[model samples]
Target: MFLCGSYVPPQYLPWSPGSYLFLLETCLFLLFACTAAGSAGSMPSMNNQLNELRSLAAKAENRRTETGIPRVAMVQGKIPEHMLAAVYDPMINVILQGSKSMTVGDRTLRYDPATYFVMSIDLPAVGSVHPSVSGEPYLAVSLTLDPTVLSTLFADLPKPVGRVEHNLGFSVAPVTTDLMDAWVRMLRLMGDPDAIAALAPVYEREIIFRVLQGPHGWMLREIAAPDTAMARVNMAIQWIRRDFAEPIGVERLAERASMSVSAFHRHFKAVTNLSPLQYQKRVRLLQARTLMVANAKSVMAAAFEVGYESATQFSRDYARVFGLPPAQDAGRILGDTRAIRP
Candidate 1:
């Protein structure tokens, strides 16, 4: 009933015009039918792969080490009402269950199991998980990207036909069967310690390769390209992250990136969707929050530690970003955690 590729029957074609037309139509119909069937067949396999990832994530939830696989981490948790801020590194987040939302500047990105998010450069973002109350939890696997590996892969792979000027450092892509299969194998390696040393690198490389062939491959490729504008912007971002507590002048940042101040501003905003000063402010606020949450530092002490000049100003800014005063928000987060615990 269905066929693929070049399949012709001698009985159906006797070198007549009518027979040739009928043969062509039949071949086309069979090709369509075969493609549809193949797609239907692959869906079950994809679902099974996602199930395996979900199982591994659930088992690794309370473990000290997220996963035995090197550079891979499993995250699973219930939804939180408040968004958590962090500087996301270069990594790929593959969702196997539930959903989550990330806010970068004014842009809001929501992704679920059908999509994977990639951070090609370090970025400050607010994220919130959204797991349903039906007992399912939000589960995801994250793989940190190694620039050295990306550089090597870019050199060996074919170059793009043309470059796009406007590229965001972060993107979300639909998960394909090939990508899912590679991720499944990478996760499976955690159970086989003997095979990991020899095979982990291979699987990691395959995963990167699959990403390089994806829609946002250009952004990932630019991460390793030293001469690209996106790379220069990334350098400035790194500088701001390293010295967020210090005052950063736009001119000095531009000089460090070897671009004109105006050009640097334009490119930086294009890539990160934030100006230099705004980016630094976000970094400082996030760092201060970390101090309060982890070290239990007082609000004023955390603010001053992150180089805030006035406690009142810091409180105002923190409230604006986090939706509450620093201490109160931190207390509420801790309280929520305690309430959620069994």
Candidate 2:
């Protein structure tokens, strides 16, 4: 059976330095050995689990069947030629046979077999999966983010021992063995629809549990604290995401989020590392691209759909942000949207 209790020192131990030293070294070595073995063993299992999920996802995609809400499956032979600008949502992605990477502003994260990434809020991201192995192909799975469950877990937790000055919306870390196993079980359930409705909830909760207890746990923690600057920034992020087409006034946004304009600006920039206008612009550009690709809107139509008044202005701003005017950029991006969201 797995050790389910927290690690605690024995009640009695000899108070001799020699004995203590030996005991410490022994325990340290054992800890190291466990960690090393767990880390190594986890990589292959993650790959295997992802492969299995990808296979199932491919079948579902081919049949145009929806697995459920929060999951978007790409089949084995299908690869998104362009990255996607995914909306504000909670989702986790696994790369089964190939590698994927996401870029958030200047920081870029790559996850292969050893690692995965999580985003707690609605943020703009660009992601892509590399061409897969000839036979294996790229496989991935996605699910929605749940906030109520996260809040429930943080109720009794102590204040952060030390707070980070900034918390990025997205983070990448090595996936643990426990998480890998939980994912494997979740993927396996896809093959048995009779069991999926009941089993999937349990497995999904288990995966979130692993996240709450894992390396990026603190990031998730920061997401729920309403008094914190990061929380305010998240509110502002939500506001912008929901109403991107409207004229965004920072003062109004700050007031809506219950902060003074200055505090709002400071905290918003601190978390997102972007000013209010810049953030909205980023959202607008991404939304415009999504509209063009998914809705088949013309450049002018897409620009208007995302709140741009002037097609020329939209093209100029789009070029500045994406380095190409709307038509050309949309064409190039539509060719492969997978690389756009991570």
**Count of steric clashes across candidates, in order:** 0, 20
Tens digits of per-residue lDDT, candidate 1, 175-199, equal: 9989999998988887787888898
Q: What are the models' TM-scores?
A: 0.89, 0.75
After TM-score superposition, the amount by which residue 213's alpha carbon in candidate 1 deviates from its true location, in angstroms, is: 0.6
- Name model 1 segments beyond 4 Å from true: 1-28, 62-65, 79-83, 132-135, 336-342
Q: Pick the candidate with the highest lDDT.
A: 1
Q: lDDT for model 1, please.
A: 0.82
* Angstrom error at residue 232, model 1: 0.3
lDDT (tens digit, per residue) of candidate 2 on 151-197: 76567556677766556777777766688778777767666778877
> All candidates: CA RMSD in angstroms?
4.2, 7.8
Which segments of candidate 2 are over 4 A away from where they belong?
1-66, 69-78, 81-83, 132-135, 153-166, 332-342
Q: Which candidate is the best by TM-score?
A: 1
**C-alpha RMSD in Å of predicted model 2 compared with the true structure:** 7.8
